[model samples]
Each structure stands twice: as structure tokens, then as C-alpha cells.
Target chain A: MPVFGFYKLYLSSDRKYVKKLKNLLGFIPGNLSLYRMAFRHKSIATNVKKGVKNSNERLEFLGDAVLGSVVAEVLFKLYPYKDEGFLTELRSKIVSRVNLNALARKMGFEQLIEYDNRMVSNTRQGSLLGDAFEALIGAVYLDKGYEFTKDFLINHIIKSHIDIHKLEQTETNFKSKLIEWCQRHGKDVSFDLVENQEGESNKLFSVHAIIDGEVMGLGKEFSKKNAEKLSAEKACEALGI
Target chain B: MPVFGFYKLYLSSDRKYVKKLKNLLGFIPGNLSLYRMAFRHKSIATNVKKGVKNSNERLEFLGDAVLGSVVAEVLFKLYPYKDEGFLTELRSKIVSRVNLNALARKMGFEQLIEYDNRMVSNTRQGSLLGDAFEALIGAVYLDKGYEFTKDFLINHIIKSHIDIHKLEQTETNFKSKLIEWCQRHGKDVSFDLVENQEGESNKLFSVHAIIDGEVMGLGKEFSKKNAEKLSAEKACEALGI
Candidate 1:
């Protein structure tokens, strides 16, 4: 703590909230209202002006962009030889809602989110936490500024919580990942066996990832499962998931 | 020009390119190769290493994120009373490919972009200009850092070229815009006139914007054209375009 931090914390009305935020983010917030608003879900928010609520939705939009830019920069520098398709996929893996929800849960975001449980479903509640996580980044960006938010995201969040190296090495679940991506985007994905060539080995299997009724990717391998996996991987690359 | 800039320009092999870039962007680039890569279309690029080439795609991806973040921040502050949906729509309008293409043309991006005309059709060439615009932003970002790039975007680009207030007030021709958006996404969008209400205004019409066979937005207005426009606008809002 700074020399005057304890004195200010003792007198502040929302000292507990400030302390918790400080403890979590490793920085004192400039605008406390932004931080509060970051956790205030639409379920509990009152309309502020012109039908715009003092909810975290706006913050989520801003934070999403901020997070995307930071992640893009990180991936761009980390993988100097990789193409945009690879960088985009790795960034998506890092910022996907499922990954974010897990990160939020691990970071105790549950304590800060202010959504009405009755209005939000049990399944939707997890997203509320992820929403708040993005909103928190928005709050930090607005409160401190872009450079500060970048530092916080890099030093405090990405460096400590994320493993970019490990993420790159783990390419085993492309089929499931592609399916989940399709589900999230309200699209349908299916793997279909393509007809084998007349002269090809009988043991070799051919598969295609049919997403939204279009063949997004094709793969041929010895095993059916491997073919499916390879096709899904190719689909992910094509879809930039 | 700054001190020694004229001297350096005299000795530089690509002094004309440097001068052209400076004239367009209102700043001298620090890293010249990054700027060169920004304009190098994949159609003209040779292999650099692995599958990656000296193309603009990676930089475009990075610049896309950077531009989104900068635009998000700008809109967030500009429209304090607006919802995220509104901000998102406005941001898309500014960053849309059509807008960027027009902007790039106005700024003489055609002269800078290096592409094989035989390989790229006339229709495809416009998007290449837009891609180079984005990649140029990425070059600026990499050369001058985020703060400097942000300042360049805001001061040199957005402030001088864009009219936010005018864009907000001018909400005409949304139907065509929506159709263009759908075409860009390879989705089908149709405006169907639903049944008119009995005993309502004689000219009243009801329309729904059906996207991918799903009713995304509905609107009721005095005229069929107005109804279609309103529905399209609502669909744009719904799609966050």
C-alpha cells in the first residue's frame, strides 16, 4: 500500500469494494463508478439515458476490443513465423467465452458480479462472470488509460494466468473445439466421410468438416478419428476460430 | 520536414515512396520495411519463411484489432448516453470495407499497393486497397507504438476525414446497407411485408428483416419503403453491424 492508502481506505464509503478490486487488479482505480458499473449486469441495472443501461454491456464491447488488440500484439510477437490464421486461432482460444468463464471463476469474479439470480438462468450466470471480466478491462481502460490497461492485462492477467506456449502445443481437441465454436456462433457443424479413391489404400479414411451445410475443410488419414480431427483442425483454420 | 529529413530523402532509394506515404499519412515512417510489407499484396509477394510471405494479411489482422479498440474508445466517450449496440453500429460504419475502400481511394492508396493486376480482378482490387489501408495502420503501430498510432488515427484520420455527428443523423438507405452486409457475410436477407393491421392507417405497412430464414427485426411504418428501411435498420442493430 502507498503511505496514504490506508487512511483513504478507512474513510471511503465503499472501502470493501475498493479493497477487493485493488487486491484483484493490483492497482487503485481512478473512477470507482466505472468499476462498479463493470460488475452491474443488465438484470439488476436501471436505465441510465436513452435506453442505455448502466450495465456492463457497453464495457464488455470496449473491453473485448482492448483484450483483442492486446492478445493480437502478444501472439504477433510470440509467433513471428506464424500466419494470421494461427495468431487469430490462438487469440480466440485465449479469449473464448468458455476460457474466459473458467478464468473468471478462478479469479473470484463471482463475488463482484451484481446480476439478479432470479432474472438470469443458472447456465447464463457463468456468462455474466465472463461479461464482468471483460467489463472490468473496460473499466480499467477508462479509469487509468490504454497503456495502464495493457500493462495490467500483460503483467497481471496474461503473464500470470495464461499459457500461450502450452496453448500452441495442445492441438488435440480441434473436433470438439470446432463443434463448440459452431454452437456458440449458432451454426451447425458435422463430419462426413468422403468417398475413397479407387487406387488409394483401403485402410485410409477421408473426412470433411461440413459447417452450415458447406464443406469447410477436408482431411485424409489412416484412421477415421484422425481424419475427422485433421478436418476439424483445417475447418478451424478456415473459420479463423 | 524535420531536420535531416530532406537530406535523408535525397539519399534514399525509395524517396518517392517515402514522400508519398508522408504526404498521405502526415507522418514519416521510422521502419521503412514494415511500411513496404503493409502495401505488398500476397498476389505479388514471394515466400519469406515457411508458409508466411511478405504479405499484408498478418498486419491487417493486427491493424483490424487496433482500429477496433481505438474506434471503440472513441465511440464510448463520444456517445455517453448511447448503448453498446449504437456504438457498435457506428464503429462498423466507420471501419466497414466499403468505407475503408473509399477512404483509401481518396488518399491515393492505389499507387502504394503492389499487386499483380493479372491475378486480381477489378472488383477484388478495391478490397486490396482497403487491406493496404489497414496494414498501413499496423505498420504505424509497430513503428511508433500504440500512443503515437492512436494519435495519428484520431488527429490525422478520424478527425479530418470522418463526421461522427453527421453519420449519427444520416440513417437513410439502411436496406441496401443491410443487403450489402448480408452479401459480404454470404448470408441471405429478405424483407417480407407482414399483414397490415386492420383499421390502421390506410398506407401503413409491416415488414420483417429475415436473415438466414430467421426473423431478426420487425418494423411498422406508413409506407412499405419506410417499413423496409426501419426493419433493415433494426436488423443492423440486431446483428451489431
Candidate 2:
């Protein structure tokens, strides 16, 4: 009863967070502290008690899992015939850091985050918005439960941002595709690193894709892998095999 | 009405599977077909329509995510004081391929799996059992929903096998620990590969841990990382810092 009383008092005290959450989630939170904690980044974490972390890290972890599960479920249903690999790739596309950062910006998630770190003001630096986005899911799961979290994601996020058709058309790795095509056609393919030069903080690499002892495509990029991919894409188009 | 009629007819046809599931899951499945799909491994998968894969792989992916979310929630509540890294490490230990394989055997999960692959008979050959274990969790989530799935995992699995204290004592990586300890004590430590010899199909790597420019400990293993870990353990014991 005492705990319940405290929770009630806590909920009543935070009308601002409650209003924000209601606008974002379209539901009143059962426990307000969980949502507040979700917004609280580790940079501003105070009162470091012994072994406990008084920040959003744990919640972010939990939210990441929850978000994955919900997305997997939706994808499982949406693409009933798609193989595991396709499902996985699509899920990754949906939850990719770049996509999440853009989604967070579109949803005004940065405005709600409680971070004291100066580095995070840049917005595009690492997984700031994405982490907060996931932490928000965790808070929703804690406040309302799994079904509600799934519903919140579906109604609020997935229907708006995730375009399944567009993602399928988007090329992920041309090198892998080219290799698979070669294997299926019984053709030998190899990628040779043609050049490597020092860049600002990385190495600029040039690669050439050789198909059946012929240099079919050439590419230059910051990483050897990317260069190979670009070369493979060119090779895939030029060879048309 | 037609779909409901077909569902009832389908449920009636699989009395044996239903009975077996009740014995295993402690509840009658709302949808037995999902559980049936959970056991359907890719090797024996039939009716491979265009984009559809009639195997447990997709279910396995979904189940893995669901299982992780539930486990994360449990760990979060159980270890209220533990940090995110600690929680992630413990979760990895619990859901690791080896541990999952062992748990699957303990729960007789392999007995029900439908795999036509010759390699799976080895039991410890790879992640076969663990994959099935995850697929089973996915089936449970689909059939009984998240709440029931969580209860099943907590009541049937975690309560029986997952000992938090024992896990905390489990040495994950001696090398990482030694490096951390060295850093804390302001001492320089490095692990170098001292030798490489040909073994069955791989090279046996010998590594030595050098502390303050002195060879403190030596180790040999199949992998450089493992060899480093072994050497680090020895160095930790020898230095006793």
C-alpha cells in the first residue's frame, strides 16, 4: 500500500512528462518514474550507489530487445513466406542506426532526452537518438507491458516510417550478391585491392572485381570492403551474368 | 466463420501433438500449428513456395528476440544493482550456444525437433539444439502470447537452471580481466603470438603475456585469443597483483 501510494504521488507530480508521453504514446503511463528514467542518459547520472547504475543504459538494452521482438513479430506476419535471412535483413534495415537517427529526428525524440553530455548535442554522433528511442520502448513496456508496446510501435512508428517495398529494392551488399550470383552460375570471381592510401583518419582503398580472369569492375572508397562492394556492383551491371 | 471452422478442424487433427505440447508446456496451445512449424527444420522443409521457407528458421529468429526480452526483464529486476555491461555479459552466458544446447538436452527439446540433416546427430556439432530451443520459445509466444511465454520461461527454465551467483563466479575471459587489472594498477601488459604450428586442420598458436617488458606467462591453443586468455590467467596467478 505504501509503495502504491508513493507511485500514485510520483505520477501526480510529473504532469509535464505525462503530457509528453500521452502525446507521443497515446496512452497514460501507469508508472511515471520508469518513463523519466528512460529519458535519463548516463551522462547526467547522479547518485552512483555502490553497484547500481542510475541511468538509461539497462532500460536501453531491454528496449532494444523488446523493439526487436515486436519488429520480428510484425515482419513474420507481414512477410509470411520470406526466409529467415530476408526477415533478418529487413529487421536490420528497419532498426539500423541511420534509420533510427532519422526517425528520432522526425519524431522529436531528441527534445525529450535528458543528456548532460556535450558530445551528444551534435545529434549525429554515435547512437544517441537511437539509444533513447529504444529506452523509450523499454519504458513503455515497463509502464504498460509487451502487447501495449507492440501496439504503440505499430500504430505510431512502423506504419509511418518502415516502407517494406522500398527496403527490399535497396541494395545492402553488392559484393555478397555478386558472389552468390557467381556461385549459382558456376563462375569464379575475385576482388583485388588495387591501391591503399592514407586518409584523414582512415585508409582510402581501391578495388577491382575480376570475373573469370578479367577485370570487370573498378571501385575506390575509404574501406576495402566498400570498394569491393562498389566494384562488384559495377561488375554485376557490366557482366550482366 | 469459415476460418474459425477450418481452425477447429485443424486443431482436432493433431491430438498427439497437442497432448505432447500440454505435457511439455503445462498448457493447451491456442494454436498448435505454430508449435508444429517450430520443429520443422530446413533440411526436411517441403512446399518451398517462391519467397516462403517452410522451416523453423524465421520462428527461431523471432523466438530468440522474445526470449532475450523476457530474460532481460528478469535480469533487470533480479539484479537491481548490476550495471548494463554486467547484465549483458550474464545474458550472453545464459543464451550462449553451448549453454542453450545443454539446456535443450536437459529439457528433451532435441527429441521433438524435425531435422533430416546428418550432422545434427552429433548433438554438439553446432547450434542445432539451441536453434530449436529458440524456435520453441517463438512458438510459445505466438500460441500463448508474451505474458504466458514469459511465465513459461521463468517457471520452467530460469528458476531451475539459471543460478546468478554461479554465473558471477564463472570466468568469461581471463585475458580481458588481466588487461583491466593491469590498467587499474598502472602496469603495461601485452600478449604476443610466440609460435604457430600446424594441427589437424588449423594452426596451434602459442602466446605469451609480457608484463613490464618481461615474459610472465606462456600458453598454447587453437586460437590466438584463447592462447592470450590462458597466458593472462597464468600471469595473473604469477604476479598476484
Candidate 3:
């Protein structure tokens, strides 16, 4: 009877912890176990049962992608006129590792993290904070639906930190700007594949944007166009036309 | 009044197009010019208006991130028990360039694209399809809220094409499986960093899994762990232990 009472008390404590988390997040709890596992760093060496996996690294990975998506979705909705570059810059700013780490610190997640004493130095703390931020995101997505995740991000991250107007203007059309500068002063622009090499892992392409038979820029990247764009930008700077 | 009549017809056609797009996507049209600009390709040379930008590339960039988020969200909900690796693989499968192109093709986006005849071949078609897919996604986000985008993806992409169970089992946690197998079979598993190179573009690492003082497998990747995992898979196959 005493053992049964102890078990009942343990269950109540678990419920209370989950309730506390829900209050902190401003959302209902769906899978508190997942959230707990998510906060458990591998360094802690906790006993994982037969069916369970270890650490929140997996959750962090999932959360990273989820956070990226939710942020992108919000950016899309908020800036209807913004082009891809603008949206990307904004999303990057919002979900940058530094920003995520800051948010994690704000959430008091460092206190909850279960890391080894040896890894408690200043440098490790930052990385752990970043990882915990990602884990929290994973936990959030698991606890609530995507809508809630989006709303949470919008309220917590974007609304508080990001300057939407500045992002919109700065991230606007680089390619167009380059092209316009070229055309306004009567110059022809073309991207030529200078060298294309297939590496052991990824294919690499070196591109040069030839303007009036002069190589304006030279760049290399995994994709031809991306490399070409980099080269084009360099060329734009070089020519000053 | 012929010019006025022409303007009236143009407005009506625009309205009809917007209405059809809204019906398909579920978000009310936010900016007609932005939408129109989103459908434009760089190949379609036109007079540069003062404030107007060319091509859907920027929108495509924004859409790419948005699509990634939406797909991530869908996968998260669909596979609650699945780990991060499983979620990533599924998301990648859904949002990969190949998959996006297929979806774009299904939507009959080729007809809607405003590209030059030179860029309409089979090879260039994939990029076009991919871009259209992104633009469509951007359009959908604008036309519908985040919920609608999530629902559309679930209905159109996940339910229709993706095999959730297969994705969940095959793609993620390969490293974990390897570790478990080693533990069960009483074999020591260790990832030895053979080479770590920080290149200008990417950080490259080579890893070898030394099982019983023998190089069981060796692989190279942008990431050390990823390289180690690849090596581990090879080791598993070679040793047959």
C-alpha cells in the first residue's frame, strides 16, 4: 500500500512538471516524456530503456529543420512583397545559432540541461545552449502542432528581435542590381563555365561572368549558377561600371 | 475609350486569374504585382519599370525555405515516434529538388511559366519545375494561412506520394543501429578521425571505424560524424560481424 502511494505521488509530480512546462511555453503538453528526453544531453549518461534512444541530438536535428520551416512560413506571410533573398536573410537572422542560443538562455534552459561537469566551461556552455534551443524547438513541435510552433516563434523570436523593414530593404534583389548596373551603361553580361570538376563527394563548378571579353568575376561553388552569381558579384566590384 | 476598354479587360483577366489561384491555394491574393513578378523568369526580357523587379528567383528562394518548413511540419506530425534522422530523410524526400519538380509537373506549372524557348528543354525543365514549385508554394502561403499550407502539403504531397513507414525505418538512426549491433555482438565501435580539413568553402573530414584494431570502413564527408557513419555502414557490410 505504501509502494502504491509512492507510485501515485510520482505520477502526480510528473504531471506537475509537465504543467509547469506548459505554463512556461504558453501551450498544452502532448508528450512530456519526449520533452524530458529532449532536454537530456548525452553527456549525462542516463539509462535509456530497451525501446528508448539517448540524448536530444535527434530531437535537436528535427527541431532545427522545424524551426527553419516555421520561421520561413512566418516570413512568407509577413512580407508578401519580399523576394527570396530578402526572406532568406530575414529567416537566417531570426534562426541564427546566436539568436537561438540567446532565446534558450532567455528560457532558462541552461538550468534544466543535464551535461557533465567537465563540459560546464564557458565555450561548451554556448554550444550546449544552442543545442538546447534546438531541443526546445523539437519539444515544442512535439507538444503542440505546427500552428502553435509558428505562433510561438512569431511571438517569442521574430516579434521581439527582428527589424522587418530593414531586412526587406537590405535583402532585396542583388542579381537585379548587378544586371541593371551593367545594362544601364551599355554592357553585355554572360556567365561562362570556366571549369567544372566532379569531386569525390560533391560536384564543383567554377564560373566566370565575361563582360566584353573581360572576366568580371571568378567564383567556385557546388552548383554552376551559384558559383556564377558569386563570380558575377566579384566582377561587379572589379569593373565598377 | 479603346485604351480604357483594354484596361478594363486586363483588370477582369487579372481578377479571374487571382480568383482561380485563391480557389486552388486558399490564401487571398495579397499583391497582384508580387504574384505576377513571382511567375516571371529572367529569360523573359521586358522593359525595367522603376520599382518592379525581374524573375521569381527571389520568391523561389523564399518558397524553398517555406516548403522545407511545411514538409518538416508534416513529417513531424505524421511520425510522432520516429527520431530526428527519420524525420530529416522524410523531409528531404518530400522537399528534394527531384520531388518538388515532380509536384510542379503534376500541377501543370510548365504552361504558366514565362520563359524563353531556349530554356524549355528537358534538362532545364527540372530547374524550371523546381522554381515553379517554389513560386507556387510562395503563392499558396500568400493566398492561404500557415494551416492551409500544412493541410495542402499533407493532402497533396505526403498522403499521395510519400511512404511514411518506409521512410521512418530506413533513413534515420543508422549510427545508433550500428552501435546497438556492436554492443549486442560484443564488438568495440570507435570513430577515428583520419583527416580534418577546413577548406575555404566547406569543412571536410575523413573517418575510419576501427573495429578490433582493424580498419573496418573508411569514408569522407563534409562532416566528421557523417563520414564516420558512412564508414560504419561500409564496415558493417564488409565485416559481416
State the DockQ of every prediction: 0.29, 0.32, 0.19
Q: Rate the local accuracy (lDDT) of all candidates.
A: 0.85, 0.78, 0.67
Q: Over the stretch A65-177, how does candidate 2's per-residue lDDT look in tens digits? A: 89999999999888888888988988987887657767877788777888877745442344677778888888899878999899989988888877867987796667887
Query: Runs in model 3 with CA error above 4 Å?
Result: A1-31, A45-54, A73-82, A118-122, A161-241, B1-38, B45-54, B77-82, B118-122, B162-241
Q: Classify candidate 3 by CAPRI docking class.
A: incorrect
Q: Residue B115 in candidate 3 has what lDDT? A: 79
CAPRI-style grade of the A/B interface in model 2: acceptable
State the weakest 10-residue window (summed lDDT) of model 1 chain A: A1-10
lDDT of 1 by residue, B1-241 (tens): 4556546666667688788888988888777779999999999998889799989999998999999999999999888889988998899878877678888888888888999999987557778887888998898999998889999999988898888888777755778888998898799989888874323456778888999887777778888888999999898767655
Q: Whose TM-score is greatest here?
A: 1
lDDT of 2 by residue, B40-66 (tens): 877777866985667889899899989
Of models 1 and 2, which has the larger DockQ? 2
TM-score to native of every candidate shown: 0.73, 0.71, 0.58
Report the poorest 10 consecutive residues by lDDT, candidate 3 chain A: A194-203
Task: Grade the docking of candidate 1.
Answer: acceptable
Candidate 3 residue B7 C-alpha distance from true site, Å: 15
Question: Which runs of model 1 end up more than 4 angstroms from their true locations?
Answer: A1-12, A169-241, B1-10, B169-241
